[model samples]
Every structure is written in structure tokens, then in C-alpha cells.
Target: MKINFDKYHGCGNDFIIINNLSNTFPKDSENQIKKICNRRFGIGADGLILINYNDKFPFEMIYYNSDGKISTMCGNGGRCVMHYCYSNDIIDNKSEFLACDGIHHGIINDDYVKVSMSDVNGYEKYNDYLFLNTGSPHLVKFVDDVSSLDLINISRNIQKSNRFDNGVNVNLVSRKNDNLYEIRTYERGVEDETLSCGTGAVASALALNILSLINSKTVNLDTKGGLLTVDFNKSNSKYTDIHLSGKVKKVFTGILEL
Candidate 1:
């Protein structure tokens, strides 16, 4: 079989997107999906996304980790999907789409895409880390230098801990200033350090705010890939109107044979 796909990346988190409007893509072909996302053997990407036709929304986003597992909400992937829709003339500048978490609203301006994120109710504060769910579970730790730490070993230890049931994404954040922070993240599903993680960035910003480390509603996050902006409103203990914005680009398009 020959599969046509478009590649896009938000920051450095790339995805292989397929227009599955005909519902012909094999949803259960985990091995094939994994092979397609393999860096050495296939069209490499951090994840795969399928833009399927939806009855209630403009489209439905079906996301899969590079490991071929249907994973939780991916912030950067969501932005890329929206941009893909806009670039393909599937929708106008604004769109509402269905994701794993729920309905998400997105807007595209030039090469930048902004998408509304899910609200966070509260967080669990630990001695050195804060645990929260921003569409996906995350453990945020404030560090002195993001680049100096051993991320692989640290994330491995955390994932093995009993604190989380399934496993959690780890974010090592170093505050550059009150509103700017540099972050390194180990994503759970990807099971490695990604260049940029949207949900991880959101979790870090909100966690810092909860600890009074940051004083602004809008925060800038510096990732290994690039810069991302997160804006939110805090009402009591609930965080709402969250938005994640960053630049996304189309890398290339090709057909893969299986």
C-alpha cells in the first residue's frame, strides 16, 4: 500500500498527518503505525495525526505516539493540525475540532497558530515537584539549569516511582525571569526528551504560578526547539481560557510504501 502524508512541525515536535476523511486508514494497525513513525526505518516523527471527517465539528483529530499507541492530547500536534486544516482550505482562520480530550478552538495567523487548551482544576504539590494534568499528566520540577541535568536518568527514576499510576511527563524548568522560563521535557508516550512539548509547557507555567514563582498570566517558555507562549486566566483554584501559541511549519510531503 502507498500512503500519502504531509509532515509538519510546531517548534521541533513533528508529526505525520494524513487526511483520513474516507476512513480508510487502518485504525488498529499499531505495527504499521510504529513502522511509519520510526526514525531509521520510516517517515520519522514524534507522532501521527489523522484528520477525519466529523459530523459535529469541522474535523476530528486522531493522534498516535511514535510508539504507535493512541495517546493523550498533544498541544503542539493540535496546533499543527489546525494549521494543516487552514493551509488545505479545510477551514477559515478559525476552527473548532474534536480531539482526544475534547473540543478545541484554534486560530491561525501567518505561520503562527494558537489553540485553546483544557482548563486545569488544581495541582498536587510535592516536596520538589508539582503534579498536574494539562490534558496530559505532568511532573514539573524547578531546576537551576535545564541543560545541565541528566534528563534520561532523572525521567527514568520518576517514571518508575509509585507516585503515578501510568507514568508522567517530566518537565525540568529553569526560570530565566519572572515571566520567562527555559524548559526541558521528557514526554511519557514518546518516552524520550522532545525538542518542545506543548502540554509540558502549560503544566510548567501553571505549576510555577501556583507556587507564586511567576506573577504573570501570560508566560514565555523557551524550549530546545524554539519559543512558545502560554496565556491563561486563574479563577479561584481553576485555570481557564488557556491558550498555547507558537510557530508551525510544513516540512515536506511524500508517499510511503508498506
Candidate 2:
């Protein structure tokens, strides 16, 4: 089978995007996606994404990690999908889209996309970490020095720990300065420290708000790969109307063989 795919990146977290609205591919067949996203033996990417039309919204998206399992909600994936959706006329310049989590609205203006993610209604506290699910599960921790920690190794250990048996994406964050933070994330399915993670960034930013590290409607985040901005409204320590803003860039296009 020949699969048409487009390569896209939101802050250097690259993915192979496919428009599978026709349902030409079987619903459960994701093995090929994993093979294609393999770094060494296949077309390298952080994961694979499918943009398909749904009766509920302008479009629906399915996300898979490099492991090829249809995983949880993805932040950056949402932004990139909108970039293609609006650009391809699947939706107008601004529209509501549905992802794995729920209905999300976004505005796409050329290279910039402002995605409105779900509000966080709950939080789990730990001496060393804060746990939250923003569409996808995330474990946020603060380190003495962000530059000195190895995100991959630490995240792998935390993900496998009995504490979070289902596994969770891990974010190591540091307050770079007032109103700005630096974050490094280890994604679950990718099983490595991706250059950027939208949900992870959102989790970290919200955690900061809960911890009183920053108090503002919008937060600036500097990922290892690029820049991402987060906006939200808070009441009684709960955040709502969360939006992630960043440069969702297009890299190239290609056809994959299976």
C-alpha cells in the first residue's frame, strides 16, 4: 500500500500527517505508521497523525506515537492539524476541530496557530511532582537546574514507576525568568525527550500557576526546539479556556510505501 503523507512541525516536534478521511485504511491498522516513524530503519518522525472528517466537527484527528499505538490527546499535533485543515480548506481560516480529547477551537493565520485546549479541572500533588491530564496525562517536576538533568532517563524511570502504571509524559521545567519558563519533555509513546510537546508545556505552565510560580493570563515557554506561548483563565486554582500559541511550520511532503 502506498500512503500519502505530509511532514509537519510545531516547534521542531515533527510528525508525518496523513489525510485519511476516506477510511481507505483499516481502523485498527497502525503498525505501518510505527514502522514509518522509526528513526533508523524508516522515515524518521516523532509520530504519525491522521486528519479525517467527522460528523461532529469540521475535522477529526487521530494521533499515534512512534510506537504506532493510537494514543491520547496531543497538543502540538492539534496545532499542525489546524494548519493543514485551514490551509487545505477543510475549514475556514478559523473553526472548531475535534481531537482525541474533545472539541477544540483554533485560529490559523499563516504560520501561527492559536489552539484552545481543554481546561484542567483536577490535579494530583506529590512532593517531587505534580500530575495532571490535559487531554493527555503529564507529570510535571521542577529541578534545581533544568540544564543539568537528563529528561529522557528521568522521564523513562518516572513513566515506568509503579506510581504511574499507565505511563505518563514527563516535563522538567525551570523558571527561566519572570513570565517565561524553559521546559523539556519526555513523551510516552515516542519514549524520548521530544524537542517540544504541546500538552506537556500546557501541563507545566498550569502547574506553575498552581504553585504560584507565575500569575498571568498568558505564559511564554521556550522549548528545546522553539518557542510556544500558553494562555488561560484561572479561578480557585482551576484553569480554563487554555490556548497554546506557536509557530506551526511545514517542513516538506512525501509518499510512504508499506
Candidate of highest lDDT = 1
Error of 2 at 172 (Å): 0.9
Each model's C-alpha lDDT? 0.92, 0.87
Q: Write the per-residue lDDT of candidate 1 for residues 1-258, one digit (tens) a residue.
A: 777889999999999999888887875788898898999998899999999999999899999999898889999999999999898899899989999899999999999999999999999975589999999999899888998999978998888888776788999999887678999999887789999999999999998899898888999999999999999999999999999999999999999776
- In model 2, what lDDT does residue 189 have? 88
For model 2, give the 10-residue run with minimal summed lDDT. 23-32
What is candidate 2's lDDT per residue for 1-258, written digit by digit as tens?
Answer: 787778999998988889888876556667877888988998888988888869878878889999989888888989998998787778887898888788999999889999999989979975589999999999898766788987788777776677777788989898888888999999888988899999999999898888788868788999988999999998886789999999988888887776
RMSD of each: 1.1, 1.2
lDDT for model 1, please.
0.92
Clashing pairs for predicted structure model 1, backbone only: none
Candidate 2, residue 46: Cα displacement in angstroms equals 1.1
In candidate 2, the residue pairs with backbone N, CA or C atoms under 3 Å apart (3 or more residues apart, or in different chains) clash, namely none
